[model samples]
Target: MGNALTTICATSDIHSPQYLELFKKALANSTCKPDLFILAGDIVEHNNIAEYRRVLELINSVHPGIPVAAVFGNEEYVGSEKEYVVRYPNVIFLHDNYRVIDTLTGRIVAVGSRGALDKPTQWQAKNMPGLIKYFRDLPDKISSLISQAASTNLPIILVTHYGVTYRNLTGENPAIHPYLASRRMENVIVNHRNVLKAVIHGHAHNGLVESIDIDSVKVYNVALPARGRIIKVEV
Candidate 1:
C-alpha cells in the first residue's frame, strides 16, 4: 500500500450551537484521533464574531492541541474578524493561501480559497450581477496557489468554501449549479492530480457527501447537512 496518512477530520457549514456540539461529541467518540481538523467554510450562520469565537473555543476546549484550519464562506465577507480567528494559538485561517503541516505520513499541505462562482441561476438571479465580474479572476488565483503547493512535492489537501467539481452539487437544484462552484478551480485540481490527496468543499448544504475521483484525486463535499458526521479521510 502507498504511504497514506489516516484520519483527517473535515466538516463544513457548522451554523448552530448544536452542530458545534456535534463536532465535540464526534471527536470524543472517534475511534482514531484526527491529525487535522478542517472547517471547510460557513462555520458561522452570518459571520457573527461570537459564533466564530465559540466554534474556535469549542474546538480548543474539546480537542486542544489539534491543528485547526479554515476558510471563510460567502456569508463571511473579508473582514478583521476573519483575521481574528487565526490569532488563536492552534488555528490557521486560509484565505487564498496555504499551510504545510508535518505528520507521520510526511509533509501534508493544505491550500484554501473562499472561491468564486460562475453565474447565478434564474431562481437566485438578482442583486449585483455586476459583482460576479469582480471575482472572475479568483479561479486563476487559486489555480496558481495549488500549482505552487504541488511544486513542494507534498501531499496536498484543497479546502474551499465553494464547490470545485459539479458532482459535489449533485443534490442541489440544477439551475443553481453555476452559482455553487468553479469549473476553473476543478480544472487545476484535475491537472495536478499526482500530488493531490483529497479536495474538500462546502456551501452546497443539500449536495452529496459522495467522493468523485478526478484522475485519482478524491473530492468530497463535506457540508454539514450533506455529511453530518466528521468525515475521515486518509491522506
Candidate 2:
C-alpha cells in the first residue's frame, strides 16, 4: 500500500462489565503505538452505553488522542446509537459510512458498518422483522461505500461487526454460519479487491481462524475472546 507503514491495533466483543478487564489487560500489554485503533463492534454488553466511555478511557490512557473508528454490533442495539454519538463526539462511528484517515504515513479509507447476515438469527427474525429488508440491502450499501472510498485513490479497510466470509468461521457450527455473516458481503470485498486492503470484524467469539486471505485481502476476526489479544495490522 503506502510507503510509510501505518500501524493499527484492533479488537472487539469486549462485552463490557464482563470482559472489560480482559480488554484493559490486553491494551496494557500492547506495546505498539498504533496510528489507528479499531473497535469492530460489540464493545459493550447489551445496550449499556455508559460502559463505552470506560472503554474509551482505557484506550486514551495508553495512547492519548489516537483516532478510533468503529461500527455497531448486535450488542450495541438499534436505538442506542445516538447515545454513543452524542457521548463520544470525537470517535468516528461509521454506520454504513466511510472515513478517510490521514496518518503520518499515508491516507487510508475506512468503511464501517454493522454488517449483514446471510440469514437473520431467530431472535432477530422474530423481534425485528423490519431488519430482514435492511439485511437484504446492506451488502449493496457497503459496496457503494467502498466504491465511494475508492475515488480517493487510497487503500481501503473494511470494518464490520459480523463475519464477512465462511472461511473465518471454521469453529462455529456450520448450521449457524448463515446467521454469523454473509457471503454477499464477501462478494463485495472480492469485487473491490483493487483498493480493499483488509477487513476486520467481530461477533464470532467461537471463530477458530483469526485471520485469512480472500482474493489477497486480509480478513481478521478480532473478537477479544477469540484471539485473547489485540490484533495489530501494518499497511
Candidate 3:
C-alpha cells in the first residue's frame, strides 16, 4: 500500500553538477538492478536540444537499453522548436501520455502531462476550460496506454511535469501558488485515483517531500531531493 521502491534513483533540476558521471556510478555501484530510473524534471536548465541529445546518449551509455521515464519541467518548455529530446527512444517523455512497463515484479503504468499555460498570469480558475480540453485530448505519448490498461493487470503510475496538488506546493510562491499547481488536474486525478497506484511530479522544486491523497490513491512529489536520492514507490 506504500510507495516503496527497492532500488531506483530519482532526481530533478539536474542541470548542475553534471550528473552523468554520478548516475553511472550509482547504477554500477548498486548490487541490485534498478526497477526504474526517473528524472523528475528540470533535467536541463534551459532548452537545449543538443544538450538533451547528449544527456540521452550519456544515460544510454550507463544503462544501455534500460527504460528511463522522464517529464519535462517548466524550464524544458521551448515552444514547438525543441524536438530532439522529445523524440528520443529509450527515454520515455511523458506529455499527457502513459506507458506500461510489464516487469517481473508487477506492471507499471506511467503517464505524463506537461505543457505551456495559455496565460501564465491568469492563474488556475481562468484556465479550467483549456486544461480540461487538454486532458480530454490526451497525447500521442499516452494514447497506447489508455487502451493497454484495459487488458493488463498493472499498477498505475501517473507521471507529469507539473504539480497537480497543492499539498506539494509548500514553499512555492504564495501569490502564485494557484498558478503553480493545477486545479483542473486535481479533478482528473481524484476521478481516477482509485485505479492509480501513485503519481510522480516535477515543477514544484520547493514542494514538500510528502504524499498527496487522490481519493484512495497516494500521489508523490518525486522532485530531486537536494541530490543523490530516490523515493521508492513499492506497491
Highest lDDT: which candidate? 2
lDDT tens per residue, model 2, 39-100: 99999998899999999999999989888889999999988888899999988899989999
Ranking by TM-score: 2, 1, 3
Stretches of candidate 2 exceeding 4 Å from the true structure: none
Per-residue lDDT of 171 in model 3: 72
Q: What's the lDDT for all of these models?
A: 0.75, 0.91, 0.58
Tens-digit lDDT string for candidate 1 (74-167) = 6565565445565554567888889887654556889987877777545434665555664578777877788888788777888988888776
Highest TM-score against the true fold, candidate: 2
lDDT of 2: 0.91
Rank all candidate structures by their lDDT, best first, as comma-separated numbers. 2, 1, 3
The regions of model 3 sitting more than 4 angstroms off are: 1-8, 16-33, 53-65, 78-82, 85-87, 104-106, 115-151, 225-228
Candidate number that wins on TM-score, 1 or 2: 2
Candidate 3 lDDT over residue span 54-152, tens digit each: 566755666566577777776675353347444665576766556676443445777666633223544333644455455444433243454456355
**lDDT of the structure predicted as candidate 1:** 0.75
- Candidate 2 global Cα RMSD: 1.3
Q: Which pairs of residues clash in candidate 1, taking residues 3 or more apart in a chain or in different chains?
A: none
